[model samples]
Target chain A: MSLEIRNLHARIAANGTEILRGLDLTVEAGKVHAIMGPNGSGKSTLSKVLGGHPDYEVTEGEVLLDGVNILGMEPDVRSRAGLFLAFQYPMEIPGVSNANFLRAALQARLPEGEELEATDYYARLYEKMDMLEMDRKFTARSVNDGFSGGEKKRNEILQMLMLEPRYAILDETDSGLDIDALKIVSHGVNAMRGPERGFLVITHYQRLLDYIVPDVVHVLVGGRIEHTGGKELALELEAKGYDWIKDDIAQAVSA
Target chain B: MNATIEAPIETVSEENDSLMTTGPDFASHPEAFRARQRAAWEKFVSLPMPARTDETWRFADVKSLSIAPYTRAEVVDDGDRAALLKKSIGIVETSGRMVFANDCLLARDIYNDTLRAKGVLWLPMEQAIAEQAELIEKHFMRESGVLGSAKFAALHESQVKAGTFLYVPRGVEIALPVETFHWLSGEGASVFPHTLIIAEENAKVTLVDYFQSAGDDAGFACGVNDIVVGNGARVTYVAVQDWNRKTLAFHLNNTTVARDASALALRLNLGGSRVRDEAVSRLRGPGGRSDMLSVSAAEDDQIFDQRTLQIHEAPNTSSDLLYKNSLNDKARTIFTGLIRVDEGAHKTDAYQKVRNLLLSDEAEANSAPGLEIEADDVRCTHGATSGQVDMEEIFYLQSRGIPLRLAHQLVTFGFLNEVIERLPGEPLQQKLRELLHGKLG
Candidate 1:
C-alpha cells in the first residue's frame, strides 16, 4: 500500500561517516511526494540508499514495501521487488541495444522455459516509445550511448514506463531537462499517476515541482526530514532558500 | 588395422625426394604427395625448436613445440564416426561441406549443383590433385610462412592429405559459403588439415574451416591454409579452432591479394591447451585490400600465441588488422602484429590494432604492435592495449537485475562481437557466435 522508511540511518562504506542520521518518510499509492533540499543535505545519498547501492551502507534502517521488509535485499532484488530507481545519471551501456536490454529485463521476470512473445513485446515497446516521444530507431540503438542530456532523462522515463514498478524513486530526473523536454517528461509521468503506483521525487531545485506538482513537499536537512507542508512549501522554499532551516536545525541540535 | 607395420619404411625416402622436386607431374600423382610428405618430415626434424630469444617466439613457451609424442592417427571406427559428424555441423545453409577425421574424409555435401556444373572446383585436396592437377599445382602453398611458423608449416605440408580445395572461375560468384570440418580422434593423435582457395578474376566466394576434437582426448593439430585472390576478386576465409582442452594446435595462414581484389580472414580460438597461430597477408597489386581479424576466448590453463604481418607491396593497396582476446582463470594470450609498407607502395594505408580484455586476476595478456614504412605519402598506424573489464560496464548490467555470471558473459560476447560483426558473411558469423556462446557456457 505504501513505501515507508522508518528511522533509516546510513553511512559511507569507505569512511563510516554517517550521512542519513535518522530519516523517516512515507509515500502512499496514487500520490507523488517531493523531497526538496539544499546542497550537502543528503538528498542523493537517500536515493542511493533506497536503491540498495553498495557504496551506501545502511547501519540501521527499516524499508517496507507493502508491509514487506526490503532492507536485506540486494539492489537487483529490490528492483524485482517492485522498487525502481531512475538514476540521476543514467548509465550508458555500449553495444546493448535498448530493445534487447529491455527485453532481457522483461524476460527475467518470466518463469523458466516460457519465452517472451516477440510481436507483443515490440508492440508494447513501440507504444511506450511513442508515449515518450522517442524515435522508433532508439530501440535498435545502443542504450543511452551518445544520447543528449534530455534524451538520457527521457530514456529513464521510458524504462520506468515499461517496467511499471509499484514504487519509483526519480532521483533528480529534472535537473538537465530543457523546457520542452521537461513538459514531455512530466506528461509521461503524469499519465502513469494512478492508484497502483507511488512516486518519490528528489530534487535540489523547485523548478521541477512547478510542472509535476506534488501533493506534499518535505524539507530534508542533514539526512532527516525537518519540515513538512503542503505544495505551497515548495514555492516558499524556492523564494526563502534553505538558510533559514539550516540555522533553525543548528540551534535545535545545540540545545 | 596395420599396427605391426614398421615406424619408418623405404617409401618415406622416395616421398622425400618427390616433394623437393616440384613439377606438373608431381602436382597430379600420389607419389608427389608422398614425396612432399617425406620432405616435410625431414624439414620438420631439422628445424630446431624456437628459442625464447627468437623475435617471432617472444613471450611464448618454446618447450610446448614437442612433436615427438604425437603420431598420425587413422580413421575412427564406425561406432564413433556418427558422433564426430554430429559435432562437425556448421552453417546450416552452406553451399557445400567436407568433414575430415584423422586426415581422412568422412562425408562430403555439395548442395549447389549449378556451381559444380559451372566449373567451380570444390573437392578434397587429394581428389583435386587428380582432377584439377594443373589448378592445384598453380596455387598450392604458393607463399612461404613469413609470420615465423616455418617449422610447423613444414610439418603440415609433410603430413597433409585431406582438406578442402576450392576454385571459383572468372565472373562466378557463389551465393553461399563452403565449410570444412577437421576433427581429431584418438589419444596423442595428430592431424594435418590444409585449405587452398583460388578465386579467379572477378570471382567471389567464402570458405570456413572448423577444427574440433572428437572427445576429451589429448591430441595435436598442425593446419595450413593458403588463399589466392585474383584481379577484381573477393574472398572471405574464417577458421574456428575448438580442439579439446588437452590438445596442442598450430595454424598457419597466408593470403595473396591481386589487383583490385580484397581478402578478409577471421580466426576464432576457443579451445586447446596451447595454440600458436601465424597469419600473413600480402597486398600484391594496386587497389588490393586485406582485413585480418581474430577473436580468442582463453580460459583455465589455455595459452594462445598469435603473430601477424600485413605487407603492402603495391601502390594504392591497404590492410587492416584487429585482434581481440578475452582471458579468464589462469589463461594467457600474446599478440604481436606488424604493418610494413614497401617502397614504391605509395598511397597505401595500413592499420594494426590489438585489444585484450582480462577477466581474471591470474590471467595475463601481452601485446606488441609495430609498423615499418618505407613508402612515401602512405598512412600507417599500429597499437596494442591490454585492460580488464570496465567496472562501470559490469555495474551497469548488474544494476538491471542481471546476475554476475550473465553480466560477464554479455560483456565478453560484446567485446568479441565487435570483430565478428565486421565479417562479411552472415551465416559464418552466426555459426561463430553460436560456437563462442557454447564455449562460454
Candidate 2:
C-alpha cells in the first residue's frame, strides 16, 4: 500500500498562483519521509492540497491513498479512506470538548447505525493521551481552546493516534514546541511507527528530522522535489542550507 | 432522563366544556389566594389582546394563537397517570421530585428527610398556599409580564393548580437538586405550571423544572418561574421546556436578588411549534448578582420569541444574560434583551449577549440587544450575534471523518452547549445534553 502522488499540480483557488507544479512523490507503507524546504517553497500548499482544503485547487494529476485516487473526494471522504492531516495550526472548536471531539471522529469511522463502545473508546483515548503526556482533565476541556502551542501539537499527535490513518501527513507538527515537548511529540510519533502505517513529516527546519529520522528525504524547491536521497540528505541540507539547492536549480535551468 | 423516542403516546379524552367561570379547586387554602386568583381572572379578561401596535408583540405570529380551543386540563386515568409518572424521570437521584400530569399531581418522591427536618419547606402549591400563605403571598406572581404575555401570565395566575413552592431556610444547603415535572396529555388541553423558590439568608439550593407532553398531542403550556434570593443566598434554577412539536408554550420568569445573593437561571426550549419566553432578573441590593441563561433548538415551523430584561438597581451588583438558539428548516427566532443600570447604581457590572445559529437558508433570526446605563462608573456591555456555522470549524470536524451532517450537528451542539455547561449540577447538564441530542436526532 502506498500514498502515491502522480505529477500532482495545484494552485491557490482565489488567486491563480500555482504552488505544486508537476510534483511527484510516493510514500509507501512502513516508511517515514521528510520534505524539507525554505519559506514559500509550497511545503504547506502540498499538505493542504493533499488534505483537500477548499482554499487550494488541484489543476491536474492525482493523489492516491492505497491506489485509490482521492483528489476528487471530499476532505471527510478522504479521511474515511484512511488519509489524515495533522494541521500546522490546530483549530480550537470552542464549545466542543476534546473527549467529545475525539469520540465524534472515531464514531464517524464506524459504519452507519453502529456506535462505538464507550468504555473501549475512553480506554483507548486515555491510553493514547497518556502517550502524549496530556492530562486527563483535557478530556473534558474544549478542544484546543486556550491550549499552549506545545499542547496543540500534542493534541494533533493525540488525534493522529486516535484516528490511526493508513497514511498520515504531519505538517510542521514540531513548530512552536520546546525541546522537551519536541522529544515527547517525536516519541509519540515513533511509538506509532509500524509496517501498517506510512507518514510524511514536512518541516522547514531540520531540527525536527533529528527526532523523526526519516527513511527518505526530499528537498522541495520551486514547486518540485529538486533532490532525493537517504536520511543523510537532511544533515547535508541542514549544513548547506536551502540556498545551495536554489542555486543548483537556478544553474541547471540556465545551463 | 429518558430519550425522546417514539414512546407510546396514550391519548386522553378531552372535555372542552370549561369556561372563564371555571376555577381551580383550591379548597383548604386561605381565601386571600382565591381572591387574588379572582383578581387575576378579571385582569386577564380586561387587558386587551396583544395587537400589532404593541411594541412587545412586534414580529410575533399573533394569528396562530387560538386560546379559545384550549380548555383547562382534566385529570387523567390511572393508566395514563402511571405512564406519565414513568416518563417523569429526569435524574436518578434527587433531593425530592413531584410529577404532575394535566395539572394534577401524579407522584411525589422525596428522598431526603433531613431537608424537612431542617425546616426546608418543599410543598405543592395547593398545600403551600395554606401552610406558607404569608411567604406565598409575598412572592407569588409578584412581577407583571412587562416583556409581553401579560394576558397569558394573568391566565396562568388564575388557572395554575399543580406547582412547586420550595424554601430553603437560613444557611441550609441542599446537596442535590429538587425536580418537578408537568406532563400535558390530552389534545387541545392547556396546563399552567408555576415554580416559586425562596432562599433564606445564606442558604443554597438548586431546583429543576421539566415541562413535557405525554404524547404527540397538541397542547398549550404557560409556565411562570419566580426565584427569591435572600442576603448571601445562592439559588440555581433550571427550566427545561420540552413541549410536543405541535404545542404552543409560554415561559415567563422573574428573579430578585438581595444583598450579596447570587441567582442563576437556565431555560432549555426543545420543542413546541410556537414558544414565547420572557425572563427578567432584578438585582435589588448591593453585591447581588444574577446570571440568566437559555438554550433553544427550533426546527421545522417552530418559532421561539424570547425577550429579557436585566435591571441593576444597586451599586456593586452585576447581571449577565446569555441566550442561544439554533434555528433550522423554516424555524424563526427573535431575541430582544435590555440591560439597564439605574442611576446611583455605581460599580454595576451588567452584560447581555444573544447568539443565534441559523442552520437553514429559510430560517430567520432577529436579534436586538440594548443597554440603558444611567450610572457613570458602571461597566455594561450588550451584543447580539446571528451567524451560520463557521465553515472552517465544520471543515476541521469533517476532515476528521465526520460527515457534513454530523459535523453541522456537532458544531450546533457545541454552540448551544456553552449555555448548558453553565449549569452547576453534572447530572442535569448531562441529561439536558442527552435530551437535546435526542431532540435533534
Best candidate according to TM-score: 2
Which pairs of residues collide in candidate 1? B15-B35, B19-B35
> Which tens-of-lDDT digit does each residue in A1-255 have in candidate 2?
999999988999999999999999999999999999999989999998998889999999988889999998988999999999998998888778999999989988888899999999999999998888889999999889899999999999999999999999999998999999999999989998999999999998899999999999998987999899999999998898989888988898899
Give one digit per residue, the lDDT tens place, for model 1 in A1-255.
999999999999999999998999999988899999998889989988887777889999799999999988877678778888888888877656788778877776788899999999999999988988999989867778899999999998988888889999999999889999999999889988999999999998888988899989999998899999889999999999998988988999899
Residue lDDT tens for model 2, B1-441? 112212221322222124342344545457888777767766776677777578887778888765767766777998998788777888777888999888777877888765565788888887888888789879998985989888889878877777899988999998888999999988778888889999999999889999988889888988898899999999999888888898989899999999999999999999888999999999999999999999999899999999899999999999989999999999999888888889999999998898989999999998888989899899988888889988888778888998889888988988898899998877988988998898776
**Structural similarity to truth (TM-score) of each candidate:** 0.90, 0.95
Error of 1 at B2 (Å): 9.6
- A-chain TM-score of every model: 0.98, 0.99
Error of 2 at B228 (Å): 0.5
Model 2, runs deviating above 4 Å: B1-29
